[model samples]
Target: MVNPVRKDGTLDPALSIKNRFIDISPPKVVGLSNGVKAIEWKDGKVIMLDQSRLPLEVKYIECTDYHIIAEGIKKLWIRGAPAIGIAAAMGIALGAQDITAKNYREFIKGIETIFDVMLSTRPTAVNIKWAVERIKRLLKERRGESVNRLKELLIEEAKKIHEEDIEVNKAIGRWGSQFIKDGDTVLTHCNAGCLATGGYGTATAPIFVAIEQGKKIQVIADETRPV
Candidate 1:
């Protein structure tokens, strides 16, 4: 479950940990999770939408190597802070699986390179660092497990991170809608919408939630064109 945004606009992380599960059924609670997932972990790889193909074609890049994911992040193929974070976690999982390690000690040593690659991709994007730290903590806590078990656990943890991202995005939409009035026009800059997040959006979440609440709202985004 996503913790409700506090009054001061910071997340109360404790609220999310109280429960083990939360329902995010689509088109029922909100239209936020209706369709389209920008990133996912599937078939033992990280599958991410190729954002550079926008307005021309829809394509997904299946990355088995952390290097591929790192390039995607650096090139903005997997754009958005939240999306980048998810990519980082999945990239770490992908990297972990290929580690030529025979034991926990060797496995831990191998992930240093993976974390370095991911962290170097986007220094400004704090979520990327945050995501890497999560994997680091997991590795530290589970350092005693067998190599195969640790690999499986890393994959599982990465998937959990993906799921949690969507949940938080939904929560953002729900909470932000309260500020959106009927017939309001929301102006935004850059890409903080569906393509930039796990789902719903960061800046666009309120608009979506408002529309679903039967409040007609307009959205004008300052869509940037690369020079």
Candidate 2:
């Protein structure tokens, strides 16, 4: 879930939780479920689960303003590599929707400003840079388009990024699941579970797939200590 971090870089306990469940369910490509969606677009806003409150309270933060989205990413409200990218894309779209420029040049400048803000949110996640660049490229290609149309296109692109990430996760799960035998045990490190990706996850997807395929494989996750 996405819980806003305080000025001191700590999550506000009022907006976070203490205990959370370990969900290893296979990623759902369609429809909604109990599994946390790292990021989502709904009714002209970006909605994210308050991951800071996971395993206990399921809270969500909605962002109609791109600045809020940027803060969310900076504060680790919505994390995971792919998920961060998705959030950046959506944040760009949200920012685009509010552009009041009367000409293409002004609109492009506004978009660039938004891009710089999002890019500065985090320095480590390459996916965020990749997603932002994709959005920038798309915007450049549609430079002559009207601001309204460009906004629509940006929103669509953001949603596309979110959808493609889930598909990629599923593909990873499918390919990785093949290595598992009926009773093979799996081990994972860190938080590479569903909470750490757009869906499924890089490291935990196979285990979920195996369980879904009726395999009795077991999973042990190492909680990378010393936080």
Candidate 3:
């Protein structure tokens, strides 16, 4: 569960869902008792679970440099629309922390460059573009602020994005569960579960919630073939 919002409206880094929800007791899935968090920040670096090795080995890759995050996204190390968006936002935050510019102008230019690289990683997910643009807008709004303050704000914004995603997923689950009747069978394709999104999932969230609500819903997932 996400912590209550702070008085300042910005999410508390200590209370952020990424810290409270992702690694700590994760939702259970058959065969994989341990839960997986696609992206997270720890020890002053961005840590991402290597999705390419799923169901075989759970490997985590630590990224201190933002460029590596771009490569990770392009190579599908982290997938799903919402997850991609969160990764992009966090990548921008990480990139901002590494800027050694002497002035705000140079810092803004450096951030813009990082934005472009992150946005170019995946074309199919509009969420990625949306998340990057959100940070870009924040940069524009705080242009007059000091570089260090702006970096802190960007990190906070990324955490906000992450926390909001978890809430959104839960709300999706709650609302969608209403439409599912007891004993209903659901058919799905590809991976849409806690592993795909911040938590819960877009398509599978309802199923999980329905079961929790005592609805005997059956789910069948298709084995998606790559094109």
Candidate 4:
């Protein structure tokens, strides 16, 4: 979740925790998740299309609710591994925003419910479950604090996970792109490109950026099987 916009239209600190670990410049917008808003991208941008709809509608739906986000994950709106993890984190944050409890015990129970709700969104994606559990662990440790405070912290932590992924991709691109020289014919499986991740696509991100930097590489897109 991108930091919730404050009254002044500035991103709140709680939303900016992800900025600490990475440099992300992709253009995005807000969508409603369960009545609470969450960050999503706009159309005609680097990572705008609902990738699963690729070569088809090119349509991108802004996910505002946890339910929608979860469905997106299951349906492959964002199919890549890193992208799924980021989406899962955002889903947890969206679910956690509605938790209301005055006492520690009740608050903990509230979070447990929220966690279960978010986790139920998808089952096959290990990264999705991992990210949700990560947030749940943090929420458990922060049970002593006010519920509102814990919500903010959990959302921020989730954002951090989303942001860190972009940096990780960049590093991988820098190192991996070097393996392919100009004019090399490379065969790739599946659709892994800019539209699949935050910064760049994994496995093929380095190849895309390398091409942009004037490094010549011929890519063979395989449509028959998984990469």
Candidate 2 lDDT, 1-227, residue by residue in tens = 56568889997877653323233433532212345577789998888876766656878998989998889888877778888899999999998888899988989888889989999999778988999889889988988898889989999999999888778877888899999988776777876666667766777777777777887765555574422
Better of 2 and 3 by TM-score: 2
lDDT score, candidate 3: 0.79
Over 35-73, each residue of candidate 1 has an lDDT whose tens digit, in order, gives: 566788888877888878875777999888889999999
Instruction: Candidate 2: list runs displaced more than 4 Å.
Output: 1-33, 224-227
TM-score, candidate 2, is 0.82
Candidate 4 lDDT score relative to the true structure: 0.61
Global lDDT of each candidate: 0.79, 0.79, 0.79, 0.61
| Candidate 3: clashing pairs of residues | none
**Stretches > 4 Å off in candidate 4:** 1-49, 224-227
> Model 2, residue 212: what's the lDDT?
77
**Per-residue accuracy of model 4 over 1-227 as CA lDDT, tens digit each:** 54478889888776663433321112210111122111243231112246564455557666556677767766766676666777777766766677677877887776666556656766666777788778868867877888788767866876688667767777777888788787666666665554455545677656655665676555555453422
Query: Whose TM-score is greatest here?
Result: 2
TM-score of 1: 0.81
Query: Per model, how many backbone clashes are there?
Result: 0, 10, 0, 7
